[model samples]
Target chain A: MRTKYLVGFLVIMAAIAYLAWGGLGKSLVYYVLPSEYADNPQKYQGKRVRLGGLVKEGSVQFNPKTLQLKFIITDGVVEIPVEHEGTPPELFKDNQGVVVEGKFAGKVFHGDNLLIKHSESYKPPQQGAKLKPEEVRKLLEEAK
Target chain B: MGNSKRKLTDSLSSFLLLVGFLVFLIGQYLAFKAPPDVQQGYLVRILYVHVGAAWTAYLAFIVAAVYAILYLWKQNPSYDRLSAASAEIGLLFMALTLFGGMMWARPTWGVYWTWEPKLTTSAILTAFYVGYFLLRQAIEDPEFRAKAAAAAAILGVVNIPINYMSVYWWRSIHQTATFDIVNRKLHMDPSMVLPMLIDLAAINILFVAFLRMKGAIAARAAAREEIYD
Candidate 1:
């Protein structure tokens, strides 16, 4: 009887230890919107974070040699430049909505990611100069 | 089956229980003191615990389904109880997953929760298990409850993979796996990998220990019912 009670106590202790450890960690989570980013720019400066918005057409610039790609991410209210290396996702294109994460420096993001959102027959279908479904499929298949 | 050996079983479980607690402490510290992330600085540390909990929860759900299947095959109450125990831990782990995910999201995604399919599926998975418990509560017959619970576990497996692959298939609010701990080319520094491994080990142990205790409690209760009936 005594042993059973003792074991239960130990289990409870372990659970507590886990929670306490998490609490003492380096930082906590912060939730907000894009407009918030513009409000207190300095508070979030130099920290790694993700920004979400639509890809701005004509804003993308690529230095093919160095693979230093640059583009603008916009929530309509704010537009921020993003730089990334390697290959962007197949669906990543102009006017496409995306979420990017990395660090912000010199008024631009050295982006480590580009997560594209494929809207399901939602709305904006780019007019003219954009790849249609067949061309898009062919492009992706060739890249692979 | 015999009371004479009850003391021994209880005592042995106590020893495993102690070891588990020690591992939990060391793991938590490792997670806390782990080095600043290469890019994210300190915010990346949240991944260690959050990922650990999420992983364990997924494992618990799978194990619960396995046990449920076994119960249905052999008509064993012990199997049902084991499934119940695993489901309970799975629920706890799923909660941890959501909390860790939300915390990570705020800094990274600029949103706490999204209507993304992955988050939605995860909510559904947790609800399924919570519903299992509710279903059990309404039934008085142990045999009937076991059958119903087993069926629920089997059906719930469909939601697990859906939660996992939701990001790939849908415009999910969740992010993809960032760094692979085992990728030789993209090796994480010791400060990062060490704590992650330690936490993983600790959580795995915790899962087992939880199962043992809950399983025993359920077993004893059923045994008592047998005597009364």
Candidate 2:
């Protein structure tokens, strides 16, 4: 009985090892900075990849009716145009750090997922620094 | 003396349960009173329960795995009971984690479910433990059942590390861990951290109470079965 159990355990462990190895190989997508991706765009083209960078200022275009989003993600040195089919997340906007998952194509990344990466640190705005009217309105709405 | 000792433990367990419930109420109040996140808004409230449940689930499984190893080494029935009790509680909290995460995701991520590595590994962990319970039920002989459950628990522990590291190992949509233990700092504001920590404490207390109760009942059931045999 002990030998039987030992063999069973060995078989199960082997199966698990095989599955984990294969799964990791298939699912492991390296997170690349925009500059890194630009350096080797052809190498990553048509392969699933995650691109992390800041949304370039004045590069956000969204159409609510069509639910289309287009933005340029930049790492201060290189910018990549990203076209996504869904509405951008509520927090997604110019200058926000974001990580998008998709495949790179010719001069555009067709992203399927957009995740806004917020800063881990939270500091209140400097005292006496006036809040923009829109910012105040947004805060009031959130309070409601 | 034994009767009085049992009574004392019973009262102690009940007291713990009451305190846990009260603390949970306080946690709820703090959760609501805390300032909303700048981005997530009121949705941030879910983090209290979600993170608490996830942490408890991880704790439960680790405890179960340790008890399983002890049972296998010493062949102690008490260790088997402890393992099963912990696994059951772990399963309950894992379910909470999944549902709470889904609810949080819908509004925040625009989807209820995605094939992200963290989400996928969590689902796998839940399914593995569910299989553990089912495997335990399928066996007829108590010794064989305990042995099989122990083996399963030991094997299933592998998923815990995989689930924990999935966010780092793979490019996942889910955010990374909230507490950076290495840095010894939290990733959120102190105001938000306080309520989450309180909730975690309350849940942990509740876990101990539930484990004690469940372990006692399992011991009784095993005893009765032996008498019938």
Candidate 3:
């Protein structure tokens, strides 16, 4: 009876292993920087990938009526234009680090999802150090 | 003396439950009253409960796994009872985490559920524990049931680390670790951290109370079974 139970357990484990192997293989997407992607855009084009970089300053444009968001992701060396449909995440902002998952096509990365990657360190800015509302308004106007 | 010990334990559990409830109310008040995030605004409030419940679920699962290993090693029925109690509470919190996450995600991520690694792994972990409970209920003989449940508990623990590290291990839409314990720093503002810490503490105390109550009930049921035999 003990041997019978051990065999059943082994069989169950084997089946689980088989399923996990296949699921992971099909779902795994590579995480790459903008510079790395720019170096060989054609090589990764049409394949699902996660690109991580800072959102370029003064590049964010959102049309609330259309629910369209356009931004340029930069790694200081290269910039990739990303167009996303739907509302951007709450934490998403200009000059913040972000990771976008989607495929590159037609000279633009079509992002289906946007995730704001906050800094690991928590350092609140000094009082009055943050950008003023007027300055933010000006920047958005300039971007438009 | 035996009756006195039981009375003491009952009083202790009740005290824990009352304290946990008061703490939860305070935490909720603070969470709602805290300043809205500059980026997420009011939506950021969900982080307090969502993150707290997720952390508590992980804690409960770890406790269950540890007790399961002890049961296997010592063949102690008490450890098995503790494992079951903790796992049941873990499942409850895990459900809360998933529900809170979905509600938070709908407005933030533009979708309720995605096939991302972190989300998928969490779902898998929840399902595995559900299976753990079903397995416990399926077996007839007490010894066979305990042995099978312990083995399942041990095996199911592999999913815990997988669920936690899924974000880093793969390209996921889910955010990375919010708190850097090794560095003693937070990824968000201190204002946000305060309420989250309160909720986390409150949920942990509540978990302890629930586990003790559940453990006592299981012990009594086992005692009754032995008497019948």
Between prediction 1 and prediction 2, which has the larger TM-score? Answer: 2
C-alpha-based local distance difference test score of model 1: 0.71
Clash statistics: count for each candidate: 0, 0, 0
Estimate the overall C-alpha local distance difference test score of candidate 2.
Answer: 0.81
Q: What is the C-alpha lDDT of each candidate?
A: 0.71, 0.81, 0.81
Q: Which parts of model 3 have CA positions greater than 4 angstroms off? A: A1-19, A23-31, A48-50, A63-68, A99-101, A113-144, B1-9, B167-171, B188-190, B223-229
True contacts kept of each: 0.00, 0.16, 0.18
Ranked by DockQ, the better of candidates 1 and 2 is 2
Q: Compute each candidate's TM-score over C-alphas.
A: 0.60, 0.82, 0.78
* lDDT of the structure predicted as candidate 3: 0.81
Docking class of 2: incorrect
Q: Write the per-residue lDDT of candidate 2 for residues B1-229, one digit (tens) a residue.
A: 2432454247667888898998999999999998777776787888889989999999999999999999999999999999999999999999999999999887776668765678767766886787677677667778999999999988888898888878767776677778765457778887878888999999999999888888887887787688789
The DockQ figures for the candidates are 0.03, 0.21, 0.21
Cα miss at B32, model 1 (Å)?
A: 2.6
Residues B64-176, candidate 1: write the lDDT tens digits: 99999999999989999999999999999899889888887666454576545666667667766776676666567789989988998888778777666655565455654
The residue-by-residue lDDT of candidate 2 on A1-144, one tens digit each, is 345444554554454454456544444553578899878778998888878889999998877779799999999999899999886777787898787889888889989988766554432234476899999999998545
* Native contact share for candidate 1: 0.00
Q: Per-residue lDDT of A1-144 in model 1, one digit per residue for the tens? A: 235433554454354344234421211221223566788888768987767678888987766568778898887888887889956654567887777767778677777866655432211122355778999999898665
lDDT of 3 by residue, B1-229 (tens): 2643565258889999999999999999989987766555687788889988999999999899899999989999999999999999999999999999999877665568766678777877787787677677666677788888888888888888888877778876677778764345578877767888999999999999999999999998888788789
